[model samples]
Target: MEYMRTVGRWRRVVRRVAAVAAVLVPLAVVSVVTAGPAQATGCRTNAHVYLTSVYPSSYRFENQPVDGGTDDYQMFAGDSTSFQVGGNGLRPYTSPAWRVESNVSGSFVFNGRVAGGNCVANETTVGLARHTVAGEVWTVRANYLTGNSGQFIQNQAHFRIFFVDPPPPEPWYWQPCYYAEACF
Candidate 1:
């Protein structure tokens, strides 16, 4: 009888924890969504870098950390930072999404999605680059990541059967399990 009572108590504790988590998780999401744009106002709340295009809206790209563990990485808006590459996420680049007053017509600004902007770059052109958590930044114009090819490992559930790239050809596309978007 005492064992059953203890089990009941444990179940109640689990239920209470689950209920609290359910409530708090949504609130955390709402707070993040609400904070993104508000923190980013007036051309830029605080830009980590400025991407210059022949037109800012004309040329936009997505990038991720090569190591995905703790090495170099790229920055995008509305993305969550994670230690692993799979844990990172990205949203499509939108024109005039976050702006700051600039004389350069094709210039736009970008920052981290969740918290205060980290790195700020001025007079920098939008080229292929990788940055680090240690506040180091660099750009790369060659050897960019192409999801159009290889169609790398991705997880999409088609009625739970699960679909992935063929084993042999194994292209490098990463557009699954990520809100129908790309994740590095």
Candidate 2:
């Protein structure tokens, strides 16, 4: 009789262990499966638009006479500048023109024009540019033109280089296991 009771106790212990393992094994597997891919995947980057301009004396007046005497109205001083991103191969993003006013005495009347619309890209992937990777730098050319009275006068060119960093990877989830497993 004692031996029978011992056997029964041992059986009960084994059953309890099996039940606990059944509950725990799936949880362990789910955590591993869900976490492994997110950690293992490589980083990714996306391209975006950015514009930076200097204040005061950044642009010249077009069509105005030099010293108000010479017909040579080159980049005088005070007007908005247009910048193009990418190059001849891509359509340039043009910035709004800023007007500059100056007195004949070399004194600045109006320094620069204020930006009116949205200028920067909010998303990582913008327009037709391919997604950028971490540590990648892009060289963009800007063609500047100044105009007055609807006539273009002075022309200048510049370049802007931008650096990109990879964005964080998305988390991973096993859809089927998540829905099917009863031990959620």
Candidate 3:
């Protein structure tokens, strides 16, 4: 009976050790594998675009951080800031929806959509060039698309572009496990 009890106790100890190893070994391996090359991407930084209006509906300037993050845009009217538009694809020459003019400084055009419209206003000769502000600004002109000014009316609309930072690179790692006296 004494010998039997000793054997049972030893078996239980071995089983308990095995259970602990089963859970802990995988965790250790994962930690080692994932411990390398952890970087903060745009998602981590909340990077985005910023804008300020010198005068309401008169003139405005926009700024975007060089880093890749939120891509948020903050628009100001008087003393209040509202959401104008924001995203991650409004770089100088990188974004497809925008075109940069050489002659005009900071000049840009919205080849894409504005407020979900095709941006086909009456004066279709709209070309956006960056303004002289420290950030990004555009000088916009409205010309009649049909060449008739009397019949067509001209309207001024204010819009801003917001761009976020690019995403960070992903990391890779390996995992290993150990079981009591056995390596698995």
Candidate 4:
């Protein structure tokens, strides 16, 4: 009968609309969920270390001064349990072009190499016992070692970077550089 055909057509149309809605509603919901603001991590806390000087041994540089010349470095403290350090240095003929290193003293241990111009960091992390170093400030005597010997340029170079605990993250906000010791 004509009435039965009309009912069948309406049911088909309703089923199509329901199927489309099922797909679209979840897609919209996923977009909104992902778009929400990122939660702040404890790693953002103020943590910094300054070189104040460069000490390259025979394997590093022959005779380079750690003064007036350019020194490159970066330091980041993650929570109170881990930290990261990376940077490059160019000391002319006396020293090699660049060197990089990092250390983590917390539950998550991490180490990386200085490759592709010091921009890319590969996470080869492993789990360890987490240990906390109290406070939000610390320093280290970072050294560059080449071969089995340390090297230095003709003159010493003084380099330093100030650390800050933060609600903001940017290079410009670091502390001013101050003289420490000569890199002989």
Per-model C-alpha lDDT, please?
0.30, 0.32, 0.32, 0.34
Off by over 4 Å in 3: 39-184
Q: For residues 48-160, could you state the per-residue lDDT of candidate 2 as single tens digits?
A: 22233322222222323323321111221222323322111111232322222222222111111221122222212112223333343333222222211222323222222
The whole-model C-alpha lDDT of candidate 4 against the native structure comes to 0.34
C-alpha RMSD of each candidate structure in angstroms: 25.5, 30.6, 30.4, 21.8
Q: Which candidate leads the pack in TM-score?
A: 2
Off by over 4 Å in 1: 43-184
Question: Local error of candidate 4 at 135, Å?
Answer: 23
Query: What's the CA error at residue 102 for candidate 4, in Å?
Result: 35
After superposition, the stretches of candidate 2 with alpha carbons farther than 4 Å from their true spots are 41-184
Give a tens-digit lDDT track for model 3, residues 26-57. 99998877665242111222212222222332
The backbone clash count of each candidate, in order, is 14, 5, 21, 30
**Which whole-number lDDT from 0 to 100 does residue 106 have in model 2?**
21
* Full candidate order by lDDT, most accurate first: 4, 2, 3, 1
- How far off is model 1, as Cα RMSD? 25.5
Tens digit of per-residue lDDT, candidate 4, span 1-184 = 9999999999999999999999999999988876653321112212111222224311112234344444443333333332233323321112122222123231112233332222222222222233323232222222332221223332223232233344455555545556894533
Candidate 1, after superposition: displacement of residue 108 in Å? 22
- Quote the positional error of residue 83 for candidate 1 in Å: 50
